[model samples]
Target: MAGGFGAIAGLLGRPSREPRLLLVHRLDERDPGDPGDPEDPGAGPPRSLLVTHPRAVPSESRGGHTLALAAPLTRVTNAALAPATNLDQTPLVRASRSMMAGLLSDLDHDGRRFGLGIDDVLLSLLRGIVLEHPDASRTAPPEATTATRLRAFIEARHTDSRLDVAQVARELGISRRQLHRHAPDGGVAAMLAERRLATARDLLAAHRALTVAEVAERSGFGTASRLRAQLARRAGGTPKAIRQAASA
Candidate 1:
């Protein structure tokens, strides 16, 4: 069980903050030995520890390849217990496999390898699950659509100095209220913040010539102070430090 979990974690890129334990034996075979018999169920299922944050996995990438999977507690339990069973028998498992195959196909189409880093693979798996089985109340919720639009908006205006929510709403022909409605969970501001910070980190790692302010602006943060605060809070370092580390 540990080996399986480790393999999946390696594929998905486990985050530093979460505590994850992977059980390795095939579900159809004997017990994996390290069953997570936590004393408390209210604390959350063992799998919950694997994905505590929504952005724990990076959803989009320059490589244009990602896969997502979300299995129901029951399904996950079954899979963990019996690895030899075909996941397709269950709706969640089938959906997850389909999503993974599609992602792999996209990567293959783009002439990229299907192999993804752990974080990306993990994000892809969860995305597939959420997309296929949103909560009944969240049915038709604008999250997926809004995320797509926001991603497009970010990509288009990655270099713009005035890339605020208002402008993004205007460009998308939607009011700020409507955009906010589309992302009620975190709203546009949170999404943009995450996107910009991630982009800034990527740029800092990739380019030495770009200044901190330049990286901030290009990444949609608008200012170095905002970027710095965000980096300190979420990325745990100053932009300069991130760049310096990248260079080193």
Candidate 2:
């Protein structure tokens, strides 16, 4: 009986080391140490449970290709492990756990050549789990929708010299105080200035023909001197230097 108990303990104690591959056609398996690197991993095998963030593109680029966007599982793991017996009983959690168990069993039986369908299912499960994670308050801001909308609106109108806190608040259909709630970091004026500066940088980089005054006007700085001052303070160089570097 002592020998039997020792064998049981050993069986239960082994770390799971089964190799797994992602189902995406051209993405390679992840190396955990360098997992967060932005370089494309290329078509190789897949590593299990590696989360990667891909940049958003224009609406035209949404389909007919395989892509994934996720942060590392470690970002939400602690929150997921929080003691929540009541949450565990929820149907969503129960279903996710059941599906995960089935996936694991299949991996053990079929030796890891999972189909794309399996990957899609697994990714959906992970997204659900991350969104419902209890410690999300500490992990990511819960008011992301407002922040996203605010940023998108700002990007669209950063070229308007009249784009101020009042304008932003009007565009977002919220009061200045409500907008402040969305941006707790530096406040509305700072956010607007940052967006305008970013627009100025993009303009300077893309159009070598545009004069400093033109770039300044188009980027909503209204005056070349103001643009120069902003560049000196925030961008660390003259607009001419920025354009020259981009051309080179």
Candidate 3:
């Protein structure tokens, strides 16, 4: 994570909270033969445009007031930034940036807090990059930590009620087959339903002011009757009983 927005903004002479218009150019992978000596400059003016999306940052990275790309995106990005000796923009890079812009915009307008949704969009963008540049994808380490990523995404968007495996796959820039491959024990749908139930349970137990209908909608259960049925099936209790117990 970066130190803070202040440091970055200070360099740009802008307010810490405001977006900074920073430029990143002249990127090259570290070469043993090239001592990185400024005097031995071989390349002309740098060609890459590095635009920071102020809304795409994760929670932890947000604490440091810095923007960060997910791990999968990072490797592809590094690969894209490397091997550049000229200002020539590759098709792959252009596509990735355009996808990135759309992802940022979607997450911002989707009325969900930043978390899994953001990661999903990023993963989807990474998937697109891989399609365009298979070699770049292969160069990065294998992503085997789908459990954590999926959990986070579910937790963030379970309230949408429309959240599902196919929607998630679309947002993550992957196919339904790929999504199943990353599914946890019961599968993505099961996991999402479980999360919604869990959230409803908590709301019922603690928030006396929220009616069962309100709890159901906010927790993504959609309706009180549905929330009641699920609660009886999985939680073995009614919303009223849960609230009474919590109050007592």
Candidate 4:
């Protein structure tokens, strides 16, 4: 968003029920009226695909033809979609401009909010590039433990009350049994509850003004009674006790 990005449009997803994937192709002079301006006419063209986001306006070096697709992020359960670092390549990037022209037949697929079923395919395309580091893949490929990915997912999404063990397992591309097989001693549910309780206590200590219910909501506990019960069973006797201890 800073210094007028040249063409980094398809690089990241936004916080939305459905991420918008923009397929970009080059345009030529003979094309119809001005396709419209690039997101940053001054910025360079995009390097890799982002989850669900608008296409950056094609740069002067590359003409602009965009195909937009939308699908619920939940529909994509692949661990690769969790994160993708920047992937900048040539030929495949430059000489590859024309390949996108093949998808024109499905242009009608553009702008529709749901039911195209390309979500998995789109995210999977970047799996190798995203999950495996270029420098390390050929030698010692880094395999993230299931526990690591699960913890990262929950850390990012715990505020959503709907989050549960099943959803976390799905996000990690594993079954509930597989998830438990790799879980710590107390198992997945205990891990999640611990995360929530940690957040609740931190909020109580840091923001003395927040109510027990507010702390519960922000910490993913869903209700003050739930927060209190956990605290009573765990370390904190109460939210007030936490704040008082912090002050002391």
**Which of 1 and 3 is the better model by TM-score?**
3
lDDT of 2 by residue, 76-131 (tens): 23122221112223345445545655655676787776543464466566546545
Candidate 3 runs further than 4 Å off:
1-144
Worst 10 residues of 1 by lDDT: 77-86
Query: Which number leads on TM-score?
Result: 4
Best-to-worst ranking by lDDT:
3, 4, 2, 1
What's model 3's TM-score?
A: 0.43
The C-alpha TM-scores of every prediction are: 0.39, 0.41, 0.43, 0.46
Q: Put down candidate 1 lDDT per residue, 28-142, tens digits, no spaces.
A: 2211243445563232211212232233323321122223333322212111121111121234444444555565567667866443243345444543443443230122334
Tens-digit lDDT string for candidate 3 (1-248): 12354353244443353223222222332222445668766533323323244333233222322322334223223222222111134555445444544555676678544543454555555445445544322232355355545555675577777777889788766788877888877788888788889888888876677788988987898999988988888778899888888889
The lDDT per prediction is 0.50, 0.53, 0.55, 0.54
Model 1 scores a TM of 0.39
Clashing pairs in 2: 22-46, 26-43, 29-45
Model 2 root mean square deviation, Cα atoms: 17.8
Per-residue lDDT over 65-115 for candidate 4, one digit per residue giving the tens place of the 0 to 100 score: 333223333322224342222334444433333334444444445743322
| Each candidate: RMSD | 14.8, 17.8, 13.0, 12.8
Per-residue error at 93 for model 2, in Å?
A: 48
lDDT score for residue 247 of model 3: 82
TM-score of candidate 2 on Cα atoms, chains taken together:
0.41
